[model samples]
Target: MDMLLGVVVMLVKMAVVLGVALGLAAYMILLERKLLGRFQVRYGPNRVGYFGLLQPLADGLKMLLKEDIIPDGVDRRIFLVAPAVVAGTALAAFAVVPFGDGLTLFGHRVPQVVVDSNVGLLLVLALSSLAVYGLALGAWTSDNKYSLLGGIRGAAQMISYELALGLSLVPVVMHARSLSLSDIVAAQAGLPFALLEPVAFVIFIIGSLAETKRVPFDLPEAENELQAGFHTEYSGMRFALFFVGEYVNMVLLGAVTAIFFLGGWHGPFLPPIVWLALKVLAVPVFLIWTRASLPRLRYDQLMALGWKVLIPLALLNILVTGALLAAGV
Candidate 1:
């Protein structure tokens, strides 16, 4: 009975998480369309569902009904698996994110997370980094020059930004003096790290946008230049997988940022889950705002900023944080 109960509970939680993530990713597409429309002084996605509420559903149906096209002479296996791998990695990264207070289920104290290792933060980082493999595979397997170029550019860009992204967390790890994400949150019980490590927070957010290949850093899929970039030849549900993965990744990054800098599940007046929702929503808005305000940097310029500006600043922030901690100041 206990074993059956555990299985049932796990399945339920998995269903809930995936359902919420899929729904959120779908709406995120609409949110971007609507918000970016306002920014550009236009109405967006108003043709489907009331106020475009059904736009995502329409889009999903379109993607599902569209023929799945596999490029001629392409590596069939890898091409088919690439998007799935990316989406899986993106979803898996959420395992350690505490959604809300622990819930009592079947007389067991079950936390919202699927797994809560001592190195939860490190695990999340590692999983996020691995998501790049999907992009690389999708591009390489397509056997097109443009796809190859986009894949190479995407891989190179992610590598450059990931270093800064990882380094920016050094200060948080240093201050919290621990790696477990829950401990990090506990350290910020009174005040958030964004207040202390402002520079690191800034670097992390910038690096995150780059990591996710958002606008102003979306050189990989610069449609005007790369013909839709890495997944250029992909169509139908395969292409939809890539699209879903992108928004899911955006949500994952936002969740990580919330836990690290903004204080995970920490707030007053509203419940913890509500606070998390508000924080996660802020990320895409910021991304869209950046897209509306800034121009994409040259590829070389983007790499240079990651290596020269963000990295050094991240390191310096760590140094200062360490010194202050040492001096008890």
Candidate 2:
């Protein structure tokens, strides 16, 4: 019965996380459209519902009702699987992200996270890196030159930024002295890492934007140059999954940024969960604002920024952090 209770708790944790994450992601679409519409000085989906509130539900229904189209000459098996790979990795990484402190229900104490793994940070990085497989495989198998180019760009950009993203977090890990995210949060009780490691905070935020393919790093999906980039051949629900994956990734990065730098679930005058929700909500809105404001970078410029600038800066920050630690600073 003990084992069964554990399983039940785990399931409940997963269900809550998924429901919130995916449900928020769905509404995020409506929010982005509304924000972007306002940004561009136009109306959004106000026709759908009151101030477009019901748009996400309508969009979800449309996607579900749409026909699934598989392009000719594509690898049917892998092509079918790629979108799931993208969406699954984006969602699965949230398992280790703690939303708030523990809560007691029915005489049981439940942790806020779905699974508080010791190697959570590493797992998130690994899962993020694995998302490239979906992009690459989907593009390569599409038998479309435009899709192929988009895939290549997407794969290269993500891999390039991954290095900097990892290095930027190294100082946080060193200061926190644990790879567990919960421990990282606890270590920040006195002060947030963002105030202490400003450089790493900037690098991590910038690297995260690149990691999620948001502008001005959205060269991978440059519509003007290579159609819709890697997902050109995808239609209906398959295409929708890729769209969903991007928003979820934005939320994932926001949560991570909060945990790593902004002090996860820590604030005054509100609940811990509310603090977390505010941070998570802020990130994608920022990303959307950026999308409206910034132009896509050239491929060469993108590569140079990641390789020549961010990575080296991240390394320098890590070195400085190491020296400070050695000096007890």
TM-scores, all models, native as reference = 0.96, 0.98
* Candidate 1, 7-107: lDDT as tens digits: 78778787788788878888999999998999999998998878989999889999999999887989899999999988889998877776765798757
What TM-score does prediction 1 earn? 0.96
CA RMSD, predictions in order: 1.4, 1.0
TM-score of 2: 0.98
Tell me how many clashing residue pairs each candidate has.
0, 0
Q: lDDT, candidate 2, residue 68?
A: 91
Q: Identify the candidate with maximal TM-score.
A: 2
Can you give the lDDT of residue 146 in candidate 1? 96
